[model samples]
Target: MYINGSWTDAEKKQTMEVINPATNELIQETAKADETDAAKAVAAASTAFPGWKKTTAKERSSFLLRTAAILREQTEELAEILTAEMGKPLKEAKGEIGLGIDYLEWYAEEAKRAYGEIIPASSSSKRLMVLKEPVGVVAAVTPWNFPVAMITRKVAPALAAGCPIIVKPASATPLSAMKIVEAFDKAGLPKGVLNLLIGSASPIVGELMRSPEVRKITFTGSTEVGKKLIEQSAATVKKMSMELGGHAPFIVFEDADIDAAVEGVVNSKFRNAGQTCICTNRIYVQKSIEKTFLEKFTARVKELQIGNGLEDGTDIGPLIDEGAVKKVQEHVADAVQKGGTVMYGGEQASGCTSDKFYTPTVIADAKDSMLISTEETFGPVAPVFTFTTEKEAVERANHSDYGLAAYCFTKDIGRANRVMDGLEYGIIGINDPIPTTAQAPFGGVKESGIGREGGRQGMEEYLEDKFVSIGNIE
Candidate 1:
């Protein structure tokens, strides 16, 4: 646990073990903080809030810039830790580290742009001003899939907005979060300005929920847990932002370039072994090109090299754990029973050292009734479904309760525009699958999530607008 500018343990000296999903090997045991520790961390943040928030945006920006520099200097080391703990390919792990650093650098500049506004007054001698101010202490619960990136996504913006924050990373991947704390410390961020709690989610988040001093909560994970947090936060009425579950729809229009569409799908769905929320959940290929797309897609998917993340030229890595593997198996089994045909890979890979490996799978003739269509598979399984018309493609894509991300591959400018406007998701990728960046808003609509991360809107999530009216102003 990192609290009040120092590294400490739980009050009872409890600890939790972190394991490498690639090999099921124990990495290390970290502090298993409880409600008491949560209270202390929140109290520390509350105490630091007045001083930290009073600092000018430029001063905070400097701290963030320094942290980014430190992270850049240690990118290789941090990426190694991420790969060892999270089981992402070394190349992908480095990319995540780079993206995390990008967040810090982007928000460092954006801090200076948290602009206020002056409103026109109706009466003479009256002035109206709207000021953007920090929303006080904040708490973040991050997911394990992109451990380093998720931490920076929440923490960078909060710190830039001049809010003290407590971050509780998923228990499976706490080391990456801890390294971030170390970077912030090296950069001399003020005590309590940023804190880390490694433990069970219930006790730490429950304590944060009960504390009135903690005014905001930002979470990136499943919708089910997001709902529970919403219920708990009702008592405090804390401002909440959720980046939750996503069953993103990837569409290949009849007019799209077949080669480009195949490449885009591979990058989007197979990257991270299809564990990402925005990874294509249901692939919709126009019936005209369904046969051609599948033939090329299957050939491409077979070329993917699967093994340990640490090994050279490994494109696909093991699933996070045994449970993740089981979920993938279940989804594949259910889809097959419901009439979906396996095109390429389906069962677990034989040569892999661990049983946590599941071969990248491609199943055709997927239907809405199948389990893969409704639930998030969160594995390297591509269930290809076909659509007949533009209307049908749009309808089938928007049928899911989740509206996080949707991708469309179309060469026609007018068709691309139409699909972009028609999709209900918060983020849409036209002819591009990996569309996320530090400068764009990343979030979802409806049950997928609430509020946005990244871009200018991200910094605003940590701020509150205060309206001031002055009368008798000379």
Candidate 2:
């Protein structure tokens, strides 16, 4: 645990054992901080607030630029650590490191351009200027999936905007985040500019949300926890930015290139073993091309190699833990029990002999009433359905409370744009499957939570607007 400008251990004598989902062994531990630790972190950030916020953008960006460089130097080491801790394939983990580095670089450039604007006033002698300033201390509560990138998503912009941050990384994979702090700290980030704690959700979160010194709550986690944080933040009226749950829909049209659409759909659903918030969980294919798409997609999915992430040719790895595997198992079992068709990969992987590994699964004839269709699987199960009309496909895709991301495949440019407009998602990819990038805005709508991350919009989230009027009468 890191608090105030130093690294400390949990005085509570409690810790969470981080187990490798790939091999079912305890890899390391994270401090399960108590309310005292959380309070101490908040107090430290509060104390450092004035000085950090007063620092020039150029100075702050110097630290961020150095951090990016350090990230590149340790990319391979950090990527390996992320793979062992979070169970993502080594390739995906490496991809995450690159993305994290990209985010820091983007924000570093964005820092020098955070300019205030002049507003029009009635009188020529009077001038109204609007300025954007840091919103005090920020408490960023991030989830385990995509651990490295999540920290960079929040910390990069928050630091660039000259705001001190106290981070609460998910207990399962805090190691990646800790390594990130190591890089930033090595880059000579000032004391108190960044703090970190790993613990249960209750008091650690409770203390931060209740503290008036913590001016904002930036979270990327489940919708249930996000709402609770929203309620708690009401007391202090602290600002918030949440990137919550998502069950994305993938729609394929009749005229789409059959082979291309099938390839895109499978990759979209099974990437990261489908644990991604913006992954395509429910796929709607046009009836005219349904049979051909499934035959090819199922065959391709069956050929994927499932093994330990360190292996050279392994395509799929285990989920985060046994609980995640069980959840995916239950969802698939329930769907089968409710009359859905399991086309392929419905059980644990034979190659991965761990309790946390589940085979990539595909289901057909799944109705909206089934839990698998409506709920987020957060695993490697893909439930697919067929639609006759474009309108019907759009309607079915928008049925869920989650609207984080949606995908559609069509060669017809006009139809692609039209469907993209109608789909109720923050991120939409026409021909592309994986749409996340540090250069673009990443966030969701509805049950997926509020605000955005990445790009220029992400940098602006930490800023608060103030208007000043000046009159020259000389």
Candidate 1 residue lDDT tens string, 109-218: 99999999999999889999999999999999999999999999999999999999999999999999999999999999999989899999989988999999999999
Give stretches of model 1 more than 4 Å off: none
Q: Candidate 1 at 219: error in angstroms?
A: 0.3
Q: What shift in Å separates residue 72 of candidate 2 from its native position after superposition?
A: 1.0
Measured against the true structure, the TM-scores of the candidates, in listed sequence, are 0.99, 0.97
Q: Which stretches of candidate 2 lie over 4 Å from their true place?
A: 472-474
* Model 2 Cα shift for residue 97 (angstroms): 0.7
Predicted candidate 2 versus true structure: per-residue lDDT over 1-474, tens digit per residue: 888767888977788888787888888977789889998888888888899888888888899889999989998899888988878889989998899889998898888888899888988889899998998899999988899999999999999898999999988888888899988889988888899988887888999988999998999999988998899889999999999998889998989987888888778788788888888888998888778888888888888778788778878888987678888988998999988999998898775558777888879888787888888899888887889999899988994578899999999999998899899999999999988898899998998989999989998889989889999933
Score each candidate by Cα lDDT: 0.94, 0.87
Span of ten consecutive residues with least summed lDDT in model 2:
349-358
Error of 1 at 406 (Å): 0.3
Best by TM-score: 1
